[model samples]
Target: MFDFVRKHTRLLQFVLVLLIFPSFVFFGIQGYSRFTGGEATAVAKVDGHDITRAEWDAAQRDQVERLRRQMPGLDPKFLDTPEMRLQVLDGLVRERTMLAAADKLHLVTTDDRLQRIFATDPQFAQLRNADGSVSKEFLAAQGMSSVQFAQRLRQELSMRQVLQGITATAVGPAGSSGTALDALLQQREIQLQRFEPKDYLAKVSPSDADIEAYYKNPVHAAEFEAPEQADIEYLVLDLEALKKDIKVPEEDLKKYYTENEARYSTPAERRASHILVKAEKSLPEAERAKAREKAEKLLAEVKKAPGSFAELARKNSDDPGSKERGGDLDFFGRGAMVKPFEDAAFGLKPGEISGVVESDFGFHIIQVTAARGGDKKSYEEVRAGIEDEIRKQLAQRKFSEVAVEFTNTVYEQSDSLKPAADKFKLELRTASAVKRAPQPGATGPLASTKFLDALFGNEAVRNKRNTEAVETGPNQMVSGRIVKHEPARQRALAEVKAQVRDRVAAEQAAALARKVGEARLAELSKAPETALPGATLTISRAQTRDLPREVVDATLRANADKLPAVEGVDLGAQGYAVVRLLKVLPRDPATGDMARLQQQYAQAWADAESQAYFASLKTRLGARTTEAAAAAASSPAAN
Candidate 1:
């Protein structure tokens, strides 16, 4: 049939069955195919349902193409991994399964509906001309023919119909009350106390003999090795060294404040009421028609007596939460509602009922109960907001001018902050001990890693001279002179005794716990069912999906497996635990609290059934697949 399709001039017949049928099936299969290899192979199977290699390859190629478009500079080597290929294949398989199921169920979208959907799609419209026709070149670039694209769209719409049938019954209107939503929003505040092994330092004094014994342990000795250190000096450029020369111009601040006035003004808001009729993707044509008729009738009644709009909304609105309150939506700013609804609501005079307004959420008949006009704030009221904007703009201009002059002055004369401060008659401030970070007030406008890098560099620190000034932010400059220098060094034994003692105690605690746990495990091994009398073992319930915090803490603090039967391992300050695998439980759909889970499982089962039907179709049709497709079919990861 495909060979005939290539040779014959009967384009319509070739397109309808050969091209259309194969493309549909190919799209479904290709989602699970790998694109990289010269040949395709299978990665997964549902029962005897085979996902072919060519299909998997095609899917992978499509994904790679998309990724390349998004991240042009991304490494091509990222696509080389078996894991990456498998992920692409899995996504393809899932989509294929759903589409196959939709076919089996005879779920379909009509040509009229598909055309309507495409016509309204913004992407397609964006590519169309004023005459309302798509450009052939653009269609080619997107890799789609009108027929092929429409078929794909129909398949998508059909799948959506099936999905809606499954999920719609479980998910009520957005305003419907449910405890599950309440539970999801609940926040828990906990007070916690942490216990460190260092707290028991005084009780865990080890003798000289103990220290020598500990040194014998390879794990303990490893901690004593000195870390590698580097000492080198480089030229530094500090930002604060240029601060003395910075001075703001009065005219610049006034100009900046004038250019950005609206930012300081507050916009108006209005309180409103509305009755929304939610639109559903799977809503039957007849039902939609009936809804439209009902909205029109309601509008007629409301228009005849506009004063009763709120009362009618209270009785008939599907939005249960606001219905009782006459559909009061409360005060909101612009961009709060669907564009059409917002435009209608905001355009209305106070106490006026709007005509039927169409939006993604069905039709709405809005009434503006009130309106508030926008207000311009007084200069004094917005003084703080204006001051912040002015300071930022002025500081930028001043810093740029000062930085250049300060840089030249330091290089020509003394390379010290004192001389620069004196020449400019600026106050000099000293910083407390700081590492690589800038000290408060000493940072000035030009604080940055670059400035810090220059300050700690060879010429500035080692040669005892001021480095060049550096730019940190826009209109900000900085340079620094080192007032004091302190080299890194290890503290003497006396100076660090407290810290060393705490470290020694933690080591002792770990060693003691390990020794006790090992002995307990040995005893348990001899008599597997024997319970150690008087030893309390705390057991707690935990879900596989989510482990409790206390359980996680206990597991991390000690090895529960090493604890003797009925003997607990101490988990520092948290508590002690002795665990044995009681049972391994698989996920139970029946036990799931979520309403969506039941629908999800039903859809999954239906998809599996659908894929099986398609596999049989492939066999009956004798679809001649390439060797690459056969290889992909053999791989477990291939969907």
Candidate 2:
């Protein structure tokens, strides 16, 4: 079909004009305006330049791909969400802001500096060839060319200069962090006494009248109510179901195994050691010739006495990484070395020495020490794996073939799932008391939000019929019908009398705990040095002594001008706490921690200073995110 269109390109162009030109003429230019002005959907603006929806979408896709590569097992549905989109848009805006700052400041990295950094940076060592040329294969693998990589690196360097200026001048306030750290880590020797509601539970019991009174209160009505539930019947059509019906012949499996034989076989590896004589391509012609002549001498010596090759390599080899180990390159597959060196090494048989070979690095006398692998497994050894692979491939192919029919069947026969289930040879499963949201530990269709939403949709609930097939995951379709639905309602006092009584008792216990805690606080304040009944420990903002945050805050905020201070904390449902602040002490520093902490503090300060400067830059450059982004950023599902 494509070939026919390609051959009749002019005719197709004319036909396209006949079809689309009439619409434009009838609708005027308004129909095409949406495409021409794609920036109408801009999500953000940086330095007066609009970031079109297309650009934002492409960036989000790239970000999702990066995350998928990083965590292969992570569900893609979780990664490509509104929150993730907002994050990707923010990152794009930051980059654009940095670029704008770089342009405004005229901060451009020269080609010479780029080259110098690429040549000397250890982080890029793998991308550099022996003679300092960028590896074309590596760039190709990353889907970039030499020029594209250079442009990207140049832009990054220019952006780096924008923040580098601020960081270089940033320093934490001298002697202030120490004082602040002292206060933050200040230790208060105190006794922690907690009056827990659970301990007071056995001490209090509510009467029948008290239980009725508490149950009648409007504030506690929701406590006795149960969530709405539905009795549902669902059907799932996925790769597993398709695979069950797939049958592969023995001949087919064997054929597949033969076609992909290399995958079942280990790649051949060669372990070679070499005696390299320095003869770089950039060397003077006379010197390179001399180096080759010296390598030839070493080759002759190694071939004459093979046992002396290790000694020869140790003395003559200039490759320092392997010099101490007698030039042992270890086991390596093809393409692991430079073209010339790899060819010479692979062509030599085991225990054979190659003639003098000149490569980008130098002239080399190579020896093939040992070789292994390149052996394919027999049919029986890999039969089970091959059959599984064939079955999976067939199932995947079958899914696409049957997906449309499956969807149509569920929608056309909306009254029941039995028809579609029988047609697809899938089991129709049922569950009682299922909520609108997924229950804990739910799996398969039950856990899918899309399927759950479809199950409880208005049409499905009202008609008690099958829902339209929903694509819950990759190549997976799910459809559900509501059989019976239970509406949310409050329970009568008699049905929840015990629960109501428990709640009344808890309220009374909590009040009792609060009263006792307050009384103890007043008594301790009057007699500061009096003995307190609790565990003695040093507490601080950093060290809570197993106490609640509220208790820790109350203890630290208490008046400690005198020798001792008493404070009470209401811990909500957990009850109350009484603390006696005995004394204050400085934080104990770990050995050599002061210097490290100071350095960390300085770095944090530098980052804050840089961020503040960047914020000012954004203001100057007029950066803003659209209302669409602001609204979607707060979507509950985004986080």
TM-score of each: 0.40, 0.66
TM-score of 2: 0.66
lDDT of 2 by residue, 1-639 (tens): 333334444543422222211111212111222222244566788767777665666666555654565455576767767777788778777877877788777888888998999888875665578988777765564455676666666666777899998898787776877766666676778887888888888888899988888988888878999889998898889988898888899989888988988899998889999988987889899999999889888888888899999998899899999888999999999889999989988898899988988898889888999998889899999998888778888899889878889989998999989989999999899999999888899988888877887888889888988888888878898888998998898888888887788889999899888888888888888997887886689877776756788987887777779877788899987888888888887785432477776777788889999999999988998888887676644443322
lDDT of 1 at 505: 63
Question: Would you give me the overall lDDT of model 2?
Answer: 0.78
Tens digit of lDDT per residue, candidate 1, span 427-452? 55444454555445654422355666
Q: What do the candidate models score in CA lDDT, each in turn?
A: 0.54, 0.78
> Best-fitting candidate, measured by lDDT?
2
RMSD of 2: 12.2
- Please list the residue runs of candidate 2 whose C-alpha ends up more than 4 Å from where it truly belongs after superposition: 1-39, 126-146, 202-225, 238-404, 457-477, 487-497, 540-543, 557-559, 589-592, 631-639
Candidate 2: residue pairs that collide = none
| Model 1 clashing-pair count | 41
